[model samples]
Target chain A: MRKFFVLLAGMVLFLASSLTFIYVKGENDSVNDLLSANVDALADNESSGGLDANYHRIDSKCEVFVSAGMQIDIFGIGIITAKADGKIAIDGKVVCQSKGNETCRPVECSDLYSVILHGGER
Target chain B: MRKFPYFSFVLSLVVISCVSQTKNEPNVQGISVDINKQADISEFVSSFDGYVCLETYEECLVNEIRKLKMVGDTIYVADDTKITMFSRRDGSYLGKIHKHGRGPGEYITLTDFDVFDSRLYVLSNVDREIIMYNASGDVLRIINTGEGFSNLSVIDEDNIWLYSSDSNDSMYNFILIGPDADVKAKYDKFSKNQSYTIEDITFCGSVSDTLYVSQYYDNIVYSLHYDGYVPLYRFDMNLRNTVSQEELSATPLSELHKTYKYKESFRSIMHIDRNRHTLFAETWCFLDGLALKTCFVKADMVTGKSHFYICGYDVDERFPLFDLSDVIGYDGKVLISYLTAFSAKKHGKKYKIGNLADISEYDNPVIVFHTLNY
Candidate 1:
């Protein structure tokens, strides 16, 4: 029984170590790939989140409704506001000026054409 | 020695789960996605407007159903075989016109072969030439494209559109055929891009006197407007909303998956959006995707802005399109026909053909608009 226990312990240790090695190797490989792909180096993780404006309009007024508590890539939190009203949530929490688009109100189908968000010029 | 069946239990669970998942999918280069949950407009098509297999005739051994056009009662298909002519009412084979190739009267491979003004025009892969034929399949004449040839479409009896793509890319557009095939019209200026080449040129709507083109490569679809401004619709393939690549890859362990750098960055848009100004698309791709997964996207292309949501079709997970001619759209509908890897059921029984490659198995599917608000 003691011998068996020892063998089991060795097996567990081996698996744990192997898994750790693979995971770390995967992370390194992935990071290298990411760097090679983007001609520009990785910007600071905390770099000012800029809005990659995917949508456009004839005039400047546009509204985006993202799910609450979702992490949005968007930055510039304080000065901007949505056309709709909802719990301003971000990062899985109801946040105040949540610094991202996902924390904003949930957009409804009624807001299809677009809501007149006050300003996103920041 | 506390080990009874603990490791065995966990390992069994993992192996069994992995095997079952692999059984449902195709072995592909890219990732596997939740294709079943993806939007399928097939249910939205009117039953009469959907595909009805020609039960009485032999199926064409064509590799693709390139460029479908419906004129009056006839359904014209430029396929791997002879140009197929069928009756629209019950999918009856009317005739297969024109031998394809470059040797004397033959065409190498037919791409976007069509009939206009009772004249048959074919784009040949063999000759890299355009050959014309009368209705009786006689060689009318291999029109002298004074410049190097690409692909051609009938602009009129005397005018043809010759499109060119990157040399590496099998697709071509910027059609400069007809009387314009000569050097003065600028037909031979195209060269392959070092990093990427033109795959194919899809015909967007011609506004007044100008025509629009869309170029597909990697995951990005560039909207080319030689005469007007066009909106570029980028579908970043790696953008994660609610699901992560870990989650998606975890769902299917039998396959290797990679999340792209962005969502909406890479995708193919062809029959999906016929009009550049309109916001509908039926896109398909094989790799640079999760493998054999095709998507139908609805894009709103108004005010030079494009927004689209895409989902995978052909859940069996095969290459999207090996040749540019794999998918088609006509009259507000799209058709995706390929060899399927999964056993598609017909009358409740699975056919012997498994996966999307067996073009012989199931009927070609059409996407009916579930949302046609515009």
Candidate 2:
């Protein structure tokens, strides 16, 4: 009876240790997955030039659904390209983002006009 | 006799009450339109009357039509720089207004013009002057409107309504000027910076004595009264993309383009016209994701039963895709639009459009006159 009691106590201790190890490992994996997802999202935002708010993308597969020569007029500003090249042109003059800027933002119409007409930033 | 008097008095009181109630009722009707609902263009457009292929020549070639108006058998087609007159009956070239210069009778830019009582009032926005010409193309007089008004509507010989989208004056967007070039009154005092440029051509349109004014960056259409204007109709498009007056005020003028671009917002209301108590507002909406959406919200001024029609997304492929971008004017009788000769020829073959059967791909744009059913 004394030998049986000792074995039972050892088994209980082993089961608790294994359960704690499994719970800790599962939590760590979940945390690592969340971190990886966040990193991937950040990388995508960076690689896309971060103008998701300004520029809209029309998928190439959906291009056939739209009319030919369909233009999105930005209220008389400049026409931002939905193509993958990400080129923005105003009245046939291509205006690029400022140098050394990782992210993109809207270029003012007047600023774009000045750049096109006077060949420099306003 | 005493009973008769009481009855008469009671009748007068009831009449007065009814009149007061009618006056107090809101003139502007709030129309709820679902932009997603696809409607057949044939439901609103009754029949195609005919097509006029504007006679094209080297000397009278219209590079682009900015505004087209018809008056007294003459169709006035104004391009960006010049105005040319063509015969309404046969599309023959009559003459061109080729007085673009800085001289006394000349204008630097022909922004807008109106034909009233055989006189042509041409507004030169850049020059800030209006040169009046008789029917024979003789210069009558030049009125120097102190401000650069981008558009003008001649109410009568005495009153003219002027609108400026490029004014630094934030107090008023419209100025009513008299014959003597004096400021008569001002309307539409928007709080935002009024200097931003918008490319809408028609601001205010008149049918009979009633003139409807479409406010810039606003959804309310107003009827111009003696002192001010009263709201005639409100277009409730239920669009997610809209900028409030506060947002417009808070946003810098330089950043306004960003506030409107690529979003599914009502960019600007163009071609506000009314015929037989039927109001039509050609609303231009930007690209929604991948689809290009343009809608025309037509409402009955009496019953307020509104119809929303989306171009290029009509129910049947047989109907011609009519976008408001090509709409020139909506007369009381017919809604006039034009299609490029290329498009007319192409769509003509596909849809079997009878009016476009005689169209040539190399010819000028075919002017299609549409009669509205609803």
Each prediction's total of clashing residue pairs, residues at least 3 apart in sequence or on different chains, is 49, 0
For residue B103, give model 2's deviation from the true position in Å.
Answer: 2.2
Residue A101 displacement in candidate 2 (angstroms): 29
**Top of the candidates by DockQ:** 2
lDDT string, candidate 1, B298-362, tens digits: 44444533333233222221211211112344544334332221112221123222232333454
Model 2: what TM-score? Answer: 0.67
Top model number, lDDT: 2
**What CAPRI class is candidate 1?**
incorrect
Q: List the global CA lDDT of all models.
A: 0.41, 0.64
On residues A82-110, what C-alpha lDDT tens digit does candidate 1 reach at each position? Answer: 21211121111111111111222332323
Per-residue C-alpha lDDT of model 2 across residues B8-83, encoded as one tens digit per residue? 9999999997887567435657778777675667667777676677887777777667788888778888876678
Give candidate 1's whole-model lDDT: 0.41
Model 1 spans > 4 angstroms off: A1-122, B1-48, B55-67, B101-103, B146-150, B168-175, B187-201, B204-210, B218-265, B272-278, B285-289, B300-327, B333-374
True contacts kept of 1: 0.00
